[model samples]
Target: MEHPALHQAMLKSTFYPGEAGPVEFHETHISRLYLTHDHVYKLKKPVNFQFLDFTTLEKRHFYCNEELRLNQRLCSDTYLDVLEIRQDGDSFHLGAGSGEIIDYLLRMKRLPEGRMLSNLLTAADPTLPGEMERLGRHLAYWHRTQPPVGGDENADLERTRRNWDENLRQSAPLVENLLTADAQNRMREEVEHFLTEQAPLLRKRQSTGQVIDGHGDLHAEHICLTDPIRIYDCIEFNERFRLADRLADLAFLLMDLDYRGRRDLSAGVLQAYDETWGTDLDAPRLLRFYKSYRAWVRGKVLGFLAQDPEADAATRTDALARGRRYFSLALGYLCRRPSLILTCGLMGTGKSVLAAELATALGAIHLRSDELRKELAGLSPSSRDLSAFGEGLYHREATERTYRALADRAELHLAAGRTVIVDASFAEKGRRDDFRDLARRQQRPLAILWLNCPDELLLERLRQRRGDASDGRPELLAAQKRIFQPPCGESRVLPVDTRDEVAYNVQRIICHLANPEFLKEQP
Candidate 1:
């Protein structure tokens, strides 16, 4: 019988125990889950594809067994058993008997949809970080105990290439309808470049036995926050998909957090995992490659669904939008090259505040010139230097020394692959030119954030300022304004009105940074 006919037959009241009012049917590419009162019956669709095949009853039965066995590793109580769907004369039943077995169903206990990690994270539960910590620790313990997947060095590299090729191939048809042609080309170029450049690291990881049998799909949606914290829905049909580098598995969850706009949570997960695993993992070093790969994979799947002939208009539209978002996210990883941001303004123009906000938002290092100068002078950051404007601790010699020190420290951070924001007055055009030269010499992207405020506002702010790292007073504002040079003719210059709300101005700066034109103009 066809799937529609089988579905109709199975929907009858005789097939289930409770009153058959309504059944929640959720369909994916390979299976249909019929959720009832206390149970969920998953029936695999008769589909044949490059990665999966379930076109026959025997294959369905075998896969049902595989699903049950694989998912039991993480969610033993939820995945119950496989049941034989029997066909009687002009009727269908739920179990094996004298009738012919038409198909198989993986019967499972129904889990609360709201308890899924995705839903809980969306609700912003206070305990999410703690829960994520526990989850990370558990994963660490699991990985340490799991047996290794023995494979030749070439096996995984070949698999990686194949996966990338498949992603590009499958996503080609939807380039015009979903992702733009330029986006597709850029994603391909970035992926190829990353694979070529990181090949040695990848090989070293494999040689050191970093690859293992792991849960192939580790997104938040597949995890539940129940008492025992059940995680389910592992890739069962393909062992090649399940066995991968442990970092790749971790990347799935981290990428999901990024997709959900929870980068802080992503950092928390990495920190907890690193702590529990006793591995000083550099998340920033390798996250972009894996995140881009995972995002492109998601985009490929959504693009496929968008172009699927059987999908309805609403489904196709949703898939297209989602595919575009994932494609954009993939491009973002390419655009996120480390930057040296110069926050320049007069003394009371909120340069420090802008730098702090941007650094926090981008998870970059905030190196304030004022704090570094005080530290160099053997004084606490809060210790006010009451010297004359350009004498004693604030002399030209000390100022030059502070600027030199800031430049050196910024390069150190840049060499370590970090974004650095240097917060300073930068009133001297020579100092500004020096920073511009430094950016060029280091081959890093540079952005100059010039915070401007009206003279009255600046005066008021300076007069009211107390216990600041900067000793700038209202008396210094007039002299600073006469000497301060506004950034001019720089393509990366982003001027902000410091009188505006801090959050609003910060978001405006971030928006500018996210622009494709701006990123493409980066040197």
Candidate 2:
């Protein structure tokens, strides 16, 4: 296939030493790479996208050298050298041939196919968790050894802000089509607020040597899970991209893990990094700011690929899907705080189901009072010895202890940097108020989801229920109805009808959670 005016003949096995086979080709927005048996050669496309320019022969030559130099910092054994594609009368040869230089190529030893972290993750490899932890430690060592990038602090902050500005500008075309307009607006406002409020932290990091030259395009795809686990293909075209607060570099990988739905891996990586440095410094604001920005940048990059004219329809469709995911992730990062979601309703209203669903959707920790109460009473989760209200484990004093334990468990989860959902009937107003006080004391956002259903439907569901953690029965529904203090006049309370279609209910809940007002404190 002809690529960048290079014909198939130019990729003959004879062009390089110890290489044989038809070349494997890969193309990105700015470069085309050919992977031979032993080595890979990357050729810059002669296109000047405003952020990067490789249009001229000299510019390509410079970027090729720059790429070779920069990538060697992390994968020294992989990046070999930059070679010129010399031209003869009718053919092109790699390396120093007696012909005019037509183009330049960055040459490197080819990594094993399907060995990248991304591939392994996609294949659901069982060993990835340990490998990811090692990767985090590796990054920590690299950051510790590398000298920090020094320059004007104010200018650096502005440069970081411009990255977000550029992302919003590039993603504008996707509004109302690939991404929702409301999401875009909310993200923009939240990002701006974060950058402004956290400016001091950014400056402090720079002043304290926390800003370092680091791998800019750090994601699973660029990481080879070999013995040494080489991470290659750093940002070589722009120094500004490569030089930033070390946390920003780390956030890129975290964002990738989040995008891949690997919250466990992400947590492991962060924990390992913190342990390696022996620091318990809390940087949630910085983490969220950078993660949101990185996700948006990923979306913008995918959008560019989707819009590329040369991509096939199938490829474009896949890019669009991936782009939407990244944008959604960005929005999620924007709104994600260590918050509490209380699923409040009488029995058979599906509060537990809704809580579980929401927790899975947001990767939040789901805490069920039934399970907690059983565990507290030294009973198995499945063991059900039904007792009347105000007797045995259901006694007033025991129930109060159970609620306190639940709130304590929720707080622990929140402290560990996770959103939490507490599933309980919350029949008593005092219990609900206790949770509200807990949230206020912690300064954590709280949303109460009150489930509603017709009494007949509730009875029907209770009758059909086979196995559940809850002990509610039709006999107790009357007492629950009498004592249940449904959420009222609370701005953070979102009342949803469990009798409605599941999809509709889920959508409404998601929309409510995404609303900034829902995250605010209620009057």
Among the numbered candidates, top lDDT falls to: 2
1-523, model 2: which lDDT tens digit per residue? 1343454754677776667888878877788888888899898888877689888999999999999888898889999999888778777787885988888888999999678999998998999889888988988888898897878776568879888787898889877556666666777777788778878877877788888889899999899988887999999888878788888899999888877878899888888888887673646768877887898888878888888888899998898867766776666665565788888888999988777656644677889998898898898888885777557778888788889999998888877878889999888777888888888867788888888889999999989887787788888799778877777875577788898644345435555666767666552
Q: Estimate each model's TM-score.
A: 0.69, 0.74
Clashing residue pairs found in predicted model 2: none
Q: Rate the local accuracy (lDDT) of all candidates.
A: 0.79, 0.80
Give the C-alpha lDDT of model 2. Answer: 0.80
All predictions: root-mean-square deviation over Cα? 9.7, 6.4
The reply for model 2, stretches above 4 Å from the true place, is 1-5, 280-282, 342-361, 366-417, 421-517
Residue pairs clashing, model 1: none
Query: What does candidate 1's lDDT look like per residue over 206-279, in tens digits?
Result: 77777888888889989998888798989887777777778778888887887776777888888888898886
Output the TM-score of candidate 2: 0.74
| Model 1, CA-based lDDT | 0.79
